[model samples]
Target: MTKKLFYNDAYQTSFDTQVVKNDKDEEGRDYVVLEETAFYPTGGGQPFDEGTLNEIRVDNVEEVDGEVRHYVAEPLDASTVNGVVDWARRFDHMQQHSGQHILSAIMQDEFGMATLSFHLGAEIVSIDLDATDLTEETLEKAEERVNEVIRDNRPIETKWMTVDESNQYPLRKKLAVDEAVRLVVIPDVDYNGCGGTHPRSTGEVQMIKLLGWSRQKKIVRLEFVCGNRVLEQLGNKHKVLNGIKGLMKRPEEALEQEVSSFIKESKQKDKQLAEQMAQLLEYEARDLASTAGEAAGVPVIERVYENRTIKTLQDLGKKIVEQTPSGIVVLVSEQKDQLQYVLAQGANCSGNMKEAAEKVMPLIEAKGGGKPNFVQGGGTKAIAADAFAERLREAALETVE
Candidate 1:
């Protein structure tokens, strides 16, 4: 079994070890075992360590039982070696993981919720807690407690004990142990059996944040960041807000009120313009229907217009049918990318407009339906307006005649 130097001391930056085995196998060449290693293995939802052993780089690290297996990309001389840990990556992991530990502890202490899962992805870190709603007051309380633990600067302790001895101590979860169990204790704040690298003291965590939470099956998933990540997020937020203010021609401090007022004014103008447009459409529809002449006792209004939507065509059809309560009114409108068909009949209409619409609609690959008198539906640009109108005229004549 390879000795785990990281479990004993997280702050250990360098170590000296004798190479036990070296060979050139399928994966080029690499040393098999080192007497000591500061590289933490990939376990406990944390990533593996990466650094250099002498001049050769350590590519990957893994753990089995208590042995740490280092996978090197190349072979180094079979002699004594010096190993150096990537302090930057190691420190980032330490800060993020330690911050998570404190946040988890506070959630359990305050709300009796257990952490279901945790992930440290490339862009964000999140924790899933087994609870539903959490009040704003509770959030503040939990945040305060976590930050207090960090400020306490308690020395983080790691110790190895027998399975039976480890069972005596209170743990956040049950101990899954066989031989010696490694316990990481944050003094009075937390004590859990973990096999991961951690900060020397709680103060090194720097900061803890509970950004937001979302509901899952029966749990709340939380997104948060700490230390350098928190600083980076805040910096990005400031840059975005400054850009928005410049685009709107407003001071950053007044952005919220300015946006709100602008939205309200825009909506009011839109409503007024809609009313005026409706009046103009009614007048236009009357003029077009007059040109179509009257059929039987009612006016057979059939006309096409551009730059009109399905809703506008239907609205104008309804207005014309109400005004000339004698015959059928058919309106066809085509916009840049779509076509619409609307057929409206007065109460004294001779034929069933609904049946006429259904029979005529399918010929154009469109849809049509009505309340026994008025029928309306539309289709894509492929549907020809003239073909649809002629078919409707034939159906209407059969019903009305």
Candidate 2:
């Protein structure tokens, strides 16, 4: 087994090690196994450490086949190289990982809530609690309690223990590994088995901020940010609010109320516009009926348009037929590489609209069927809507005669 340098010192930023083996992964990517490494591999819900090996970018690190392989952007030619960990990223992980320990411990102790799972995400950290009845009041209390422990600046101790020795402390959760049990203990606060890295003390975690929570099946997943992440989240939210504030012309404190008012007003205006459009469509239907052509024994009205919805065509066709008894209406609209249409007839008409629709469908590869007096459907623009409309007019005159 390769010696683990990060196991002992989470704060170790740089180390010198020799490449034990240079190998290629299954994908033909070059990787190296070091004699010893300070780079923490991806494990225990924490991401892998990113930095450089001899100035060559170490894209990923993982324990594969009992050896910690550093997957490099390019193969490392040097036998001996200096490995440096990105401290900003490493420290941020520590803050979130350590803060998770505190937050989970307090939830279990105070709320009888067991953490079902934990995930340290790139932007936010989350823990799924077994509790179904979690509330904002409980979160407020839990946040305060967790921050209290952070303020205490309790020492975070990590040590290897035998299965029997681990029984001495009350662990928050069971150890996954039985042989080499490693426990992260927060003095008298929390004792749990975890392999992920952490800060030196609770104080180094800065603070725990519970952003929000939602019920996921039976568990409650709580989202939050810790340490500098809390600051980053705040700054992002401020930028969004500032931009909206300028657009709304409202003070920061009054922005929420003003936004709510603006949405209400916009909805009202949309309703009024819909009403006016409906009245205009009614008048347009009358104009179309006045210019109808006589086919067989009924007045036939047909029009093709671009970019009109099938629903609008159906409504207009129905209105024209209703207003002019014994009249036939055929409306088609070209809609981006396709065409839609509606065929309708008023009462006292023997025109077989369904037959008329069938006669023109094959030309456009369309499938439509309706009663003896009405039909509606659409298909790809294999043929122009205007040409298809003429075919329908001829078919209708034949069906009626």
lDDT for each residue of candidate 2 in 247-335, tens digit (9 for 90 to 100) = 98888889889999999999999999988988888999999988888866679898999999877887788788877888888888998
Ten-residue region with minimum lDDT total, candidate 2: 173-182
Q: How much does candidate 2 score in TM-score?
A: 0.82
TM-score, structure 1 vs. true: 0.62
lDDT of 1 by residue, 93-185 (tens): 888888888888889977798887887755467888989877788888888898899899988888889878877777888877788888888
Give the whole-model CA lDDT for all candidates, comma-separated. Answer: 0.78, 0.89
Off by over 4 Å in 1: 20-33, 55-59, 64-67, 71-81, 259-401
Best by TM-score: 2
